[model samples]
Target: MRKYLIFIFIVLAVAGCKKKNKAVTSTIPGKPALTTPAQNSVCISGTIISATESQVLFTWNPAVNTDSYDLVLKNLLTYTSTTINTIDTKINATLLRNTPYEWYISAKQNSSSTTTQSDGWKFYNSGAGIVSYPPFPADIMYPAFGQVITPSNGKIELYWAGNSVGNNIASYTVCLGTTSNPPAIKNGLTESQLKDVAVTANTTYYWRIITFDADGNYTDSGLFQFKIQ
Candidate 1:
C-alpha cells in the first residue's frame, strides 16, 4: 500500500507539470492588427515645414502578451525607412509633402525572441493645402542607383516616375554627365523615359531629373550614378 501511494503521487506531479507547460506555450503572442490610414489611402493632408509636424498618426490593435511595438514607415518613392519603438498602440509621424509612404507595426514580447508584424498600409501626404502642395521630385526607375553595366552595353535607358499631385506635370528635363552635378542633357522632355542614351565604356555617369509643373513650379531629383563596363 505504501508503494502504490508513492506511485500515484509521482504520476500527479508529472501530469501537473505537463499541464503548466501547455498553458505557457498557448500564451505566445500573435500578430497585431493594423488600423487607421486604411489600406491604399491617398491625399492625406499635412503641414510641410522645416520643423517636424505630426502629419499622420498610426494605430494598431495590441497583440496578446506583447510588451512593446515597433512602427516602420517607408517612403515608397525614395526607398527610405524609419522605425520607432514604443509601448503604446499608437504613434504620430512626420512625412514629406506630396509623397507616398507605406507603414507597418511589429508587436514584440519582452521575454520571447518572436515578433508579430501587422499588415502594411500605404498613404500619400498631400501637404498643408492644395496651394501649399508642390509636385514631388521624379523617382528614378531604371538601372537602379549605383548599378554597373558590364560588357560595354554602350547604351543606357533612363526612366523615372513623375509626380502630379495638385498640379499637372508639364515636362521633364534630364541632366547626364561625368560630373556629380551634371548639366542638362535634354530639356523640356514630355516623356517619363529616355532610351538609347549613349555611354562611354569604363566611365561613371551621373544623372538627375527636373520636373516642371503647369503652374511653373519645379522639383529636382537628386543625382544618381552608374558605371559602364
Candidate 2:
C-alpha cells in the first residue's frame, strides 16, 4: 500500500509539471519586410497635407508572432528621426516635401521582450518645382559612433556606402579630425572604403562623409566618433 501511494504521488507531480510547462509559451517576432516606397526610389505625393508637407503611405509585410510594430522615419538633411508605434502593418505619415528620408520597421511581441528590426530603405519625397534631389546620407560601415578600438598598427580603415535616387554619385569626400567640425581630409574618392588611415592609441577621432551627385546636389553624413585604445 505504501509503495503504491508513493508511485501515485510521483505520477501526479510529473503530470502537473508537464501541464504547467505546456501552458506557457513564448514567441519572438519576426523581422517585418518593407513593401512600398521601394528602396532608393522616389515617393510621389500621396495626399497633400500642406504646400510644404505631404502625406506618405509606408507599408510593410506583417511578421509572425508580432503584436505591434514601430516605424522609424528619419530626415536625412536634418538628421532628425521620428518613431511611431502601431499594431497594423501600414501607416500614413506626414513628411516635408522635397526631402530625403530613410525608414525601418521594428517588430515586437507581448510574449517576449525581443524586438526584430527590418532592413532599412531610403527615398526622396517628391515636391513641386524640384528638379533634382540631394543624395541620401552615406551609411557608415566601420568606426561607428562612440566606438572604441585598439590601433595596434597605428592605422584604421574608414568605410561607408552611399546612395542616391539617380545612381549619379560623382564622388565621395571624407572628413576627419579631433574637433566637432572636422575638415575634409580626402576628396574625389571614387570608392566606398579608404584604407590605412593613420590613427593613434588612446585618442578620440571624429569623422563624416560628404556625397556629391552628378547634378551637383550634395548630402552630408552626420558626424560619428570613435576612440582608440
Candidate 3:
C-alpha cells in the first residue's frame, strides 16, 4: 500500500509539471502598432536643420505582454536600414534629408523567441530644399514597403502616384528583379500602375520607378522591396 501511494504521488507531480511547461510555452506577446508618420504620408514637417541636427522621433503604441520593442527604419533611396531596440515606446533617429522612408515595429519578450510585427508605414522627410519640385519621382503605392503576398494571390499589381509637379511627367518606367538595382523590366510605361506581373513564391523582389519629363529631365524613385509568401 505504501509503494502504491508513492507511485500515485509521482504521477500527479509529473502531470503538474507538464501543465506548467505548457503555460509558459503558450505565452506570446502582441505586436506593437506604429502611430506617427502615418501610412503613405507626404511632406512631414518639424525637421530641425542645425549644426546639431534634430532626429526623427518615432512613436508607437504599447503592446500586451511585450518586454521590449524593435524599431526598423529604412531609407528608400539609399537602401539602408536601421534597427534599434528599446524598452519604451519611442525613439529618436537621425535620418537622411529629402528622402522617403518606411518604418515598422516589432514586439518582443525576453522569455520567448517569437515576435509580432506591425504593418509598415511610409513618410517623406521635410528636407532643406523643395524635395517635391517639378519632375518629381513617382511614389510607389502598391505592394507597399515590406509587404508579403501569397503565391495563391496570382499576378501582382504594381502601382504608384505620378509626379504632382508641372505637366512634366511624360512617361514612367518600372524596374523589377530578384536583386537590388533591378534593371528596367518595363520601360516607357505611360500609366501610373502595372498589372499581371509574374512572381515566384518564397522570393523577394526589389523594384523602382524612373520618371521622364517632357523637358528631357528624369528622376528615379529609390528602391522598394516585397516578399512572396
**lDDT (10s digit) by residue, model 2, range 1-229:** 9999999999999999999897775487898999988999989847888889999999999999899999999999898999999999999999999998999999999878999999999999989888788888999988888999876589888999998988889999999998899999999998998989898778889999999999999999899999998
The TM-score of candidate 3 is 0.61
Per-model lDDT: 0.79, 0.92, 0.79
> Candidate 1: where are CA atoms >4 Å away?
1-55, 59-82, 87-89, 94-132, 151-153
Best by TM-score: 2
Positional deviation of 53 in candidate 1, in angstroms?
3.6
Q: Please, what is the TM-score per model?
A: 0.60, 0.91, 0.61
Candidate 1 lDDT (Cα, whole model)? 0.79
Candidate numbers sorted by lDDT from highest down: 2, 3, 1
| lDDT of residue 81 for candidate 2 | 98
Model 1: per-residue Cα lDDT over 38-86, one tens digit each: 6655545444455434367788888898999999988866768999999
Which of the two, 2 or 3, has more TM-score? 2
Q: How many residue pairs clash in each candidate?
A: 1, 0, 0
Residue 37 error for model 2, in Å? 1.3
